[model samples]
Target: MSYADVNGLSMYYREHGDAPVTEDNPALVLLHGGLSGSDDFAALVPELSAHRRVITADLQGHSHTADVDRPIRVETIGDDVAALIKHLELGKADVMGYSFGGGAALRCAIQHPDAVRKLIVVSFPFRQDGFFEDVRAQQRQMSPESAAFMKQTPAWELYERTAPRPEDFPQLVGKMGEWLQQPFDYSEEIRGLQVPTQLIFADADMYSMQHICDFWALLGGGQRDAGWDGAARPGAHQLAVLPDTTHYAISSSPALAGTAERFLR
Candidate 1:
């Protein structure tokens, strides 16, 4: 484990693979989901690291990285990641994020465009309203009590084992509840993005198919009929809806690594 003091954060990040740093092949930075740590990407990291250097970090208030007095907003955390990347003496890296981290990754692409080669977001959207009503309803129920209920789960177990402040778990949950209560939209930003990007979601993910298509439309996707020469298909941006997966199980899907690898390639 290595640490970098970026923007007042002693961020924890680990590097995998011995691939040399080069302009054509920047390192990959992987961000874990909410209440999850770097270990959340354990299965997918090795799949990616064999060919490139993969950096995994625990976001602020998760595990390993302690929280600051600041609120946990997507844009703020994205800034933290940009600072961390620059602190490492690198200009940029292809970023992949899951769930909560996915939102931050999207913000990084939005806020720090010059510092990204390619962007991948797994099961994420630009706005809180993109989520299913049931999911939002459940999010409203999050509190210290919910954290207590999840204390016995594997993600919580990992947090207790490695979090910088194990006692702050409930507070983290509350903060997330507050963050989700607010809504935002980044569709315009996505439409203007020049960097090649990929959006991957499970067939049964939290977002509706219509919502996903609406998001994709902003990226110049699903707009016109192809001329059969692959010339007028759509924009460079891509979208993938993995089969036989749900919001909870999508991270573990065998097809995710391969799909993302192809897109990153």
Candidate 2:
């Protein structure tokens, strides 16, 4: 566990691989999902670290990081990351964020473009107008047994929801409960992002596939007159649908990492 004071907040992070002090071999910042902390990328880090220096951190109020007095917003989290990069003297690095962290990565790219070189967002909800209402409704429709199971089951069990043991159930429930309260909104901010971006989604993800498609289209359509090559190029902005994979595709499927590595390169 390493600590860095960023914007008056003590940020905790795990660094993997050798960070080359050259501009050519930049580091990769790995942002985990909302409920899950840097632990979410535990399995993928070894693979990603092999290619680039990897830095994973627990967001404010999650994992070992302390919570702030005010309500947490995605922009605030982005600012924290920006401060961390500046504090470390890391000029520009690639960012890969999953789920809720995906939104935060996008916010960082928009807010501090000079710090983020490339962006990769997996299973992110960019536009939250009608999307969040559906999420709220889905939460309301969850049965007591299902809700209880989610709250009590371990994250590993949640990742592999088959033959879960009694001990694993509580952690899952607690994680789900925490996710229900996390704050994230980027509908207004996403349109301002000018960095090269890639969006990845699982076929069996609970989020809207159409929305993801629309987002890719919007970003590809020249959101800012910057003329994003990924959007304009045929293969730019690769939209991969991992077959038989869930929202946690990065952990569930090893093939997803290969695809992501290629996209990042």
On TM-score, the leading prediction is 1
RMSD of 2: 5.9
> 88-180, model 2: which lDDT tens digit per residue?
777898888887788778888989999988888888776554254666666554432454445544543433432113343334334444445
TM, every model: 0.97, 0.77
> Which has the greatest lDDT?
1
Given candidate 1, what's the lDDT at residue 91?
Answer: 76
Against the reference, the lDDT scores of all candidates come to: 0.86, 0.69
Cα lDDT of model 1 by residue, 1-265, tens digit: 8988987888999989999867887989998888788887788888989898888988988899988888889899999888888887667789888999998888988899888889998998777789999999999998876888896798789889998789999988888888888778898888888878889999999998988899888888888876778787555678899999998777778899899899878
Which pairs in model 2 have colliding backbones? 150-173, 151-173, 151-174, 152-169, 152-170, 152-173, 153-169, 153-172, 154-168, 154-172
The C-alpha stretches of model 1 lying farther than 4 A from their native spots are none
